[model samples]
Target: MEISSQIPWSTIAAVISWYSSNIGVLLLNKYLLTNYGFAYPVFLTLCHMTACSVLSYIAVSVMDVVPFQSIQSRTQLVKICGLSVVFCFSVVCGNISLKYIPVSFNQAIGATTPFFTAVFAYLVSRKREAWITYGTLVPVVAGVIIATGGEPSFHLFGFLICVSATAARAFKSVLQGILLSSEGEKLNSMNLLMYMAPIAMVVLLPAAILMEDKVIWITIEIARNDIRVVWLLLFSSSLAFFVNLTNFLVTKHTSPLTLQVLGNAKGAVAVGVSILVFKNPVSVVGMMGYGLTVIGVILYTETKKRYRL
Candidate 1:
């Protein structure tokens, strides 16, 4: 196969793990919110971030998969916190969006993140993508627009929050590269995560308190009544950690470009799994739009790769 020939077996493993973790966590979150009636997106995200911090800490401090180092400067600390705030917002919005929209539509909306990233890069960084790269985004945007129009499960508020989450994610990516890409400051995945998790918790605590804390007592009782719910939450949280770990591995082995290309397929995979698992309705026209978006993503990846951007 072309993939077996081109990608190392280890990289293939990483990619598989990445997809599994992403899809698994998403399905679990959907179940928690919809099936279990745990209506606390911010709190759930806080729990996942807590789990990630514990996992990263164990890897760095105990297993020594990555070395533990303290971030020294206030400026650097502020930057990490800033990134965390954006990350927390994006993730929480993503979860909330899922509460109101089907996973397939949510993932489809997320497929537009790259387009927003390019738009932001153009506006804020004055970076010029290749014309083809720019051209390819046309279909990406158009497909999302088409898909949005036809999506049977579309909710305007959910759509807006999902769009906001996608934009926040793009902004987070750009800001991270601009602020934290320095070799002297760079921490590997585990260590960077070690710092980011607590910061996200700190940043998220207030929001969770403001939004979800009102029902906190009742949700706690429900979680206690159902031990399986607790376990599922823990499982989803652990999968969240694996998602980042495997994403790092794949990106390290293959290029970020390869990971991006792989991610385009991930959208379709998530959609397919959601349909099979959740029995969410999808029209032929909607799928055509999703297919257009995936094709656009491939074209966009090729454009960026061809120009070495």
Candidate 2:
């Protein structure tokens, strides 16, 4: 399919915007991790959802585009709920993984999502992918293995959680792609997010209540004492909105494999920042692994051109 024709200037702009937003999110997440601790994901989700819901309501009220009463549809509702669950799982695992690993390492490993997504898509959709696509998987896997450095003492549970988060993200991408492709031309970024953010917020609420406990109350105390926490949460929420919108746009504009390449770059950027800003240590083995992973991504991208895979 000629995806370019499907994605107009607005979509391209959204993609760029989303990319910028993701970078901002990375920086914000790093700072928040250093200051507010890892539980920030729960708080971040809560604030983002609350803010989006309020903004959406205001937009609906002012524009009166579709009557609030008339906006309910079973299919849309279902899709929203599905997307929400996927988002929650992805974020929870991802957030937790950060507590155990540096952002850069997490991103490098996460870049393997395209390979996983392809594997999952082939199994679930029964689509026949080009053999070259399968070939590309070699370097992707190699890169991840190299980046991980086979550290015997590494946190196994944390690594597993991060991998699960990556898989969840990949699944979400494939599902969203299917949804967009089948839903006609009206499935724009804002529309998808409008439905997704609220549902995700709803899903997160109970999880936060159950997990946060007195820590939930503590976030308030922290926010009051350190105003930066509040700002971080607000920034994190905005970043979430931007990242979700851009990610969907990228999927719509380019192939899933291309998105994976971007993911690789994002991981590198995060790692670079973590090392510089947070002084996170990068061991020699970890550096070697990162090199292999990047090289694998390059090889995979180059291969995709000749094979349409």
**Best model per lDDT:** 1
- For model 1, the local distance difference test gives 0.87
- lDDT tens digits by residue: candidate 2, 1-309: 687787677766865676678867766765666544645566566777776665555544566533343224676567657866897788778777776776777777787776778777877787656787677678778867876774433567778988999899888878776654553323555555566667878788887787777657787788678887777787777676657656766777777676766666766776776678667667777777767767766676676566763
* lDDT (Cα, 0-100) at 109 in candidate 1: 82
Give the alpha carbon lDDT tens digit for every residue of 1-309 in model 1: 587897688888988999999999999899888877888889889889999999989988999866688897899898989888898889999999989999998988899888989988878788788887899999998998889888998899999999999999999888887878787777677788889998898877788888876656766787678778678878989999998888878878887776787898898999999899989888887888888888888888888878754
Q: Give the top-scoring candidate (TM-score).
A: 1
Candidate 1: where is the Cα deviation over 4 Å?
A: 1-8
**Pairs with backbone N, CA or C atoms under 3 Å apart (clashes), candidate 2:** 143-293, 146-289, 147-289
Off by over 4 Å in 2: 1-20, 38-40, 52-73, 150-153, 184-186, 245-263, 302-305
**TM of each candidate vs. truth:** 0.94, 0.79
